[model samples]
Target: MFRPLAVVLLLVSTEPAAAAGLDAASINDAAPPSVKLPGPHQVNASVARLEIMLDRAHFSPGEIDGKLGENARKAMIAFAGANGLSFDKAVTADLWSKLAASSDGAAIVNYTIAEADVKGPFLEKLPPKMESMKDLPALGYRSPREALAEKFHMSEELLQALNPGQKFDKAGDTIAVANVLDAGNPAPVARVEVDKTRQTLSTFDAAGKLVAFYPATVGSAEKPTPSGTLKVTAINKNPTYRYNPDYKFKGVKSKRPFTIKPGPNNPVGSMWINLSAEGYGIHGTPDPAKVSKAESHGCVRLTNWDAGRVAAGLAKGTPVTFVESAR
Candidate 1:
């Protein structure tokens, strides 16, 4: 196992620049962050190990891609705040020492792919348009590779890059991968904060301790997010998305209403925490990297895992407040 002695952490803005007119289908091609980043695009062993440490601490950095991108900064900011460390400035030896003490494991590990992992219940391909998704059996992951990538908090491309010439579609295949932890089972929530300006979702426990933090795509200028507080009207898991023509979604030519079945790839991803603002909810997204860096059709969108955890922490009448960023 490769160990990192010290990491020069430059405070980079986790918020990426917004692309032009981000509709539902525009999941890939995220705009780079405005801040001058310290690291190059190449994968860094030190950075990957840092990602594992942060994830184990519960400040998820989305997919553990080796690049020190916006999601990693988000995790860093949250972790820094929780521990009373400076969110700004470089990560010195002392900071790395604290992080190293937080977790006890190798950044990478070996796991055997089970028969259930390569099961054929996966979707071969998903339609380009959300309307076309209505006719499909369900909005599941397009392939076993995608499922495995999500399971380990990795990008499909990174997974392939890490294991060249290895087929992820087989059972009983042991592979070296990131030792990422699952977003722990959700805890009870006292309050939820949806910061549209900062594009973040944070929740506080009954004692007002920050329990979770996630990058999110909030309402856009065309469809502005509602102001003030809203109550959680419903918590629907494995939710079905009903697209009404009244919403006037860009590029959606369907005048008639359509129902898209539930799965991780669904437009609303997997979980739906319905808000008091009708037709508006905090939902999940197929594109985890695009959250907080893209525009939405009048909804707050978190990464699927983050959204699931947020939903788990909330009840039928939990309060969700929309406001300015904490910074």
Candidate 2:
């Protein structure tokens, strides 16, 4: 069943709380100051640096918001486990050193806004309902800020906090952004694992070594995810979302089928890895922050960039196994 993609809409706060003590210099510092774990979701240079490093290492912290949120914490633990280090919800010096050593280069870098970035037949506003989206010409980003934020795997609020008073619509404008461009191609994925309990997706190489880890949003109670093994059938980029009446997704009143145009804001985001299961696939999401934090209808949801990476390393017959507990 192709159920409606449930998302916790991001309410961008007007307050500049995420901008506190956040500067390009601090974020680019070689030795970032230690950050306390289980802290509030406040913008801190240390957390930003950690997120960038983890992202570069292919252990995505999901929408680098410059905070030690649940996604970030999960990434840290997974990275530590892969590196033979013990982590217990704390960022010890050794763990920080290991993470820093795993990837080189500054976390934050300056990026000049380009003409293509600002030039958009941008949407003035997007309707909250899925049925209303089918009529639009293209479901492109609502604004340049949103486009840029997704470009660098950053939260819209974090991008704005990094460049206060600077409008993202202007070209030739240099601004601080997360340096999470391309982390390079990973090893060929021999198998893919989705742990529903942990809300994580991991790719393993032929030798059974963990290649990449990502926080994921699995299915909800109303529409639980499928169990057992599945295989990758196809990979689609910039995929259009088709809604079926059989899904009967909440908030969607339409009984007929419809298709939503392809764009970053598209319900399926940028990439879709079709699985052997009829209506189940591991796909990208428009809401990166909600990954692993929200419940999906049935499919496995990942950050758009993370999904792209996973798709790049996947093959047509690669096995995808879903489990309730860690294997």
Candidate 3:
């Protein structure tokens, strides 16, 4: 790994500048006290070790964004959980110590179709079609994180936790869908009902079985949840979000023509089920516990895990009836 030169190239706006270069002096002078290293520093052996562990554990940092963000934290937690290590979002010396000792290198744990059925959170069928790591470049996988997310049956958040430093090339190959059944006995089909007035999301299985229920953050009253029968028009894994300036919240200036690269910080957590109604889909949020109490721009928001499961469970063009909650 090349040692990144410490530099600070200040941008007046969020947009990328055509002529961008590192100002090592400016960055070194203004380095934040919290980071310890100067701003815009390159990946070193420490971060490299972190990245290798994360990748092996299957937390695809996508193109090694280098910045430690929420997705990375989630992956770290998952890795720690698997190892029976107590974890907090903040990085600790203990975590790094464990990371250095791990035998797994940078090799990703690829998911393949197996006879044993596995399931994802929110009821998404597991072992999503076996995709090749090589396919990532063709799929616009800008980062290894994105590529790994598509390859594994998980999200970039999981990847970020594993690797904190790396750059991703968005153009990656797509995987071939390999069928794998869920191991658990299929829960009864659900007849889901949404109540925007009450901000609730309910699911009923095929037998009208009440399998799951959750509180949701519905669209704001001003841009109320649309009223109509809808279907999940499409589903995407680790989808990139194009922020439309026209639809942005007031006082929130989006980096124009910017696409929120797919990862933990992605407004749409991981899987997105586009609805028959335009711009209205059931998706996940970076913050799940904060749902229901909050308001959405216009879509239904669930936890990232929940939304991904929902995406895996629902088929394209699945019928979804929309009606107000009796509440």
Best by TM-score: 2
In order of listing, the candidates' clash counts read 1, 0, 44
Best by lDDT: 2
* CA shift of 171, model 2, Å: 1.5
Candidate 3 residue lDDT tens string, 124-195: 121121122112222232344443444443335433433333233222322221111121222432444666
Off by over 4 Å in 1: 1-40
Residue 142, candidate 1: how far off, in angstroms? 1.2
lDDT of 2 by residue, 95-144 (tens): 78887787777788899999999999899998888998999988888899
Candidate 2 matches the true fold with a TM-score of 0.91
> lDDT score, residue 50, model 1?
66
Clashes of 2: 0
Instruction: Kindly indicate the candidate among 1 and 2 with the higher lDDT.
Output: 2
Which lDDT values do the candidates have, in the order given?
Answer: 0.72, 0.82, 0.46
Candidate 1 local lDDT, 91-193, one digit each (tens): 5455566666776666666779988778867787778898789998889887878888877877776666656667788898987676765436546899998
Question: RMSD to native for every prediction?
Answer: 8.5, 5.8, 15.8
Query: How many steric clashes does model 3 contain?
Result: 44
**Model 3 score (lDDT):** 0.46
lDDT of 3 at 142: 38
- Score every model by TM-score: 0.85, 0.91, 0.44
